[model samples]
Every structure is written in C-alpha cells, then in structure tokens.
Target: MKRSLEFFPVQLFAVIMGLSGLTIAFAKAWHFLNINYFEAIYKVLLLLDTILFFVVFMTYIFKWIKYPEAVKKEFNHPVKSSFAAAISISFLLISIAYYDYAPSVSIIFWWVGAPLHLFFTYKVMKFWIEHKFEVGHINPAWFIPIVGNVLIPVVGVDAQPEMVNIFFYAIGIFFWLVLFTIVIYRMIFHNPLGKRLLPTFFILIAPPAVGFISYFRITFGLIDTDSLFLYFIALFIFVLLLTMFRQFIKLQFFISWWAYTFPMAALTIATILMDSAYDTNLTYYGALFLLAVTTLLVAYVTYKTFIAINNHKICIPEEE
Candidate 1:
C-alpha cells in the first residue's frame, strides 16, 4: 500500500512536466515571444523540467532497487520500469547537453542514456506483445520518452552525426508505427466502448504526427523532399480535428483536449519545413496561419483545464 501510494506523485509529476514542456516547445518554435526574452523563458522551463526529470528518475530507481522482486512480481513485467528509468536519465543528460555545461558528464551520460532508452523501448514493446495489453489504455510507461523525443531536438543538442541518435530516432519511428497500427486496428475492428474510445484514438494519432514532424526536421538532408510528408500530415490533422469535433458534441471533453495541441503544432512546423523544400508562398502562409490558430486554441484549452483543475472538476474515470 505504501509503495502504491508513492507511485502516484511521481507519475503525476511526470505527466504535468510532459505537458508543460510540450507547451513551451510549441511557444518557442512558433516565435511567440521576442527572441531574447523567449530564449530566457525557454531555458528556465527546460531547467525546471530537467529537475523534475531527475526527481522522477531517482524515485523510480529507489522503488525498483528497493523492491526489485516485488516490482517484477506485481506487474509481471520488468520492461515498463526499465523503460521509465531510461527515459528519465536520458532527459537529464539531454538537458545538460543542451545547456552546454558539464561536457564530460554529459557525454558519459548521453552514451549511457541513449542506448538504454532504445533497449528499454524494445523491451516494452516485447512485453506488450507477450501480454497482449489492450490498445485503449494509455501505458503510463511511454509517457516520458514520447515527450522527450519531441522536445530534445528543440532543446538544441546537435544530435546529427551521432549513430546512437540516428538509431534512437529510427527505432522510435518504428515503435510509434507499431503502436499506432494496433490502436487503429482495435478501433475499427474491435470497437472498444465507453471513455477509453476517444482518448485512445487521440493518443494513437498523436505520435505519428509528432514522429513525422521530428523526422522531417532531423532527416531533411537524407530525404529528397518534405512536400510528400506534409500532404499526409495535413490529412491526419483534418482527421484529428473531425474526431475532436465529434467528441465535443458528445460532451466528453477532458484532458484529451490537450492531445490536439501537439499535433496541430507539428502540422504548423511541417508546413514550414515543406516550404523550405519547395519555396511556395502559399505553403508558407498556410503554415503560419495554422500555427497561430492552433496556439490560440491550445491557450484556450489550457485556461479551461486550469479552471477545471482548480475547481476540482477534472475527473478521469478510474481504470478497471
């Protein structure tokens, strides 16, 4: 009972930090603030997120080390705990590297953290396959790494030319596709009911949208053109918007609203990248418009969420 209670705060902190980091990244990427001021604010937020990463990391390590056998027994799975640890440490090292301090420590931690993340990601997928976990449920384990993958590049860590970085990105794309495929299959064929349905769909589509955006920027030189990529991205954004409208009418708006912010932000970035590839004015303007609109929408939802949480109205149904 004591151990179970302890897990709640760590998990809550991670989720909150993940959401905050993504919000900051979108603001920075969209040039919402003046250059000098934005850089200062961005750095501060990154630092706070980095500190939270360590707190969550150390908490997990303590839990695992203290009750290794119990952890293995309870979940009947070691991979989730292992992946959570890898993701936390990776965030810490990447944060240090981005700030350009502590080179020796950063390099060592980077080397250790990256491969462990890749290995643990694979292990988690294997566990999912072995156990046949349901698609509708959000696996709390993947939460940190998913956010880290998107935010790390924006943090300015010059990951190019590093084989480990390349491999990590590649494997990340693969796992994202696999998980996304499973969710879509479940939605269409199995038709999971109740609250899980919509949240599951939002989560399914988000990673690919994010993965495509990340790869487009990171692998620009490797790919011939980004135009082809943007077309599919725009399609996904439309689908997601339509889905969200359906949910809103049903009066099921909850934290799932935050899901739209990341992908819409990605679509905006992808449009900019596409313009660089093709140099079309329409694409450039369209991307800018989308970015502005999405930012406003996200700001509104964030306000609503703040109000809901403050008034103690943010209720997520308990998982069975």
Candidate 2:
C-alpha cells in the first residue's frame, strides 16, 4: 500500500466531527446574536461540512476494505480503538446538524449512530474490564463514548423514545464523574502527557459544557440550581485550561490539536444557552467572551494546520 493512504488513521475522523460540530455551535451563537447574515454563514458551513464528511467517510471505508489487518491493529490497541466512537459521534452530530432541515432524515442518521455508539460503549468498557489496568494509559479519549451518551439526549429527545434518551443522559452524567476522578488523579500523579497528546487534555472542558447544554435541553430550557452547577463547573474548566495556555502554545501543531476545538465550542454554546434562558447580564457578556476566545483559538489552529499541510508536516505516520 502507498504510504499516504496507509498513513490515514481512524482518529482523523475527529477532525471532521469537531469542525462540523463547531460550525453548528457557532451557527447557534450567531443566531442568538441576531446577526443579519447568520443564515448564509450557517448554510455555507453545512455545505462545506457535508462535502468533507462524505470524502473522509469513503476514504475510511476503502481503508477498512483494503487493509483489514491495519484496521485490526488499531481496533486492538486500547487507546486507538476508543476513537472508533468518533465515527458514530460524527454521525450523531451530522444527524443533529440536519435535524431542523429535514427531521425525518435526521432521525435516520440518529438511529444509525445511536446504536453503534451503544455498541462502542460496551466494547471499550469491556476491554477495560477484561484487560490489565494501567493508570498511565488513561487519556481523555476514554470519555468520548460516555460524552456521546450525554449528548444523545440533546438530539434524541426530539427523534427517539424519551426514556431511551434519558437513559443515555443518566449514563453520561454518572460515568463523567467517575472518569473525571480517575483521569484527574492520573494527571496529577503521573508524568506529563506526550506532546502530541497534550491537546486532548482540553477535552476536560467538554463534559460539563455538553452536560449543561443537555440539561437545558432535557428541561426544555428552564433555569434552576442544577443549571447553575453545570454552568459554573464548565466555566471553571474553561478558565483552568485557559490558564495553561502556555503549555498548549509551546507544543507543535498536529491534527490531534483539533480535539481542542469542539470542547470550546460546547463551552461557548453552553454560555449562549444560559444567557438566553437566564437573561443574565454576565452570561450575555460571558458568551461573547468565550466566543471570541474560541474563535481565535480555532482560527490559529486552522492557520497552523494549513501551514503544516502545505509543508507536508501533518502526514507523518508516527504522528498519525
């Protein structure tokens, strides 16, 4: 097999998912801002995302067909296989993105993604139970499937059985805490993460943000004490990661860095939801501040990525 095609990793799916999800998140933010051109911006994003999504999807399908052994290696690796959930998550977000445009169509994608996500959750957790435990190997990627559970309700409440969606929500909320504790413990006691994996630490910002957004959706947009808890927790994590900016900036750019994008988008979207629902002056400004920060970070990442790609720096097999 040619090196270029062989170098593609299933984890690269994260890029499409993260970028598409960010587009949707920013779409919501612009709508909230009553931007005059929000519709055009959103439609363009949806179009671009649709094209990229299918191209990557087909590329992966071909990889699996042509290189089954390589696929097996990735699936067997504890850390890499956890990323398979990103495929389903991408489907879920694609479903959500199209939810309003053609709800019946969206339901089809949701069903397709949701069942696969359930299976992924089972497979990954089973590996943990059946394999030898290692504290150091734990990474935020473990939270990917669990976070998808929490996120199911965000769109599932509209597309599927309410009980099923609520079940997903409960699972997400429970394990998010469980995994957060273990991951944080590992981070504090273990050596620093490898440079390439450093961007994934930003994933810590996501669960609370997504959980807060899901809580708002489940409650049908009511404000309450739990809302306060989720929002404040997300805010704290955002600030915590922000304070460690030097660590992120010093690291060389890589596709994994795109992992940092959607979490911030989730954080931004959470604040926007709070602002609209709670009618708080602070939340109003807070949303814009987070928006600015997320926008700048994403822009910088995109710019560096373009530079890297032009220089052929991103296609390295070791990094993938």
Best by lDDT: 2
Query: Candidate 1 regions off by >4 Å?
Result: 1-113, 133-162, 217-223, 249-258, 276-281, 297-317
Local error of candidate 2 at 85, Å? 0.7
Summarize candidate 2's per-residue lDDT along 65-93 as a digit string, tens digits. Answer: 88788777777776787787888888888
Model 1: what TM-score? 0.63
Clashes of 1: 0
Clashing residue pairs, backbone N/CA/C < 3 A, model 2: none
Report the C-alpha displacement of residue 13, candidate 1, in angstroms. 6.2
Candidate 2 has a TM-score of 0.94
Residue by residue across 1-320, what tens digits does model 1's lDDT show? Answer: 11252232222332333334343444434352223554555456456556755665676567678757644543343223423443443453344334333455455555555556555455555665587555544442343343334433322235346554555555555655555455456557764445522432334434554455556546643334443553475556567657567564564545545545545555555555555566576866776576567657666766876775676544332233
lDDT of 2: 0.79
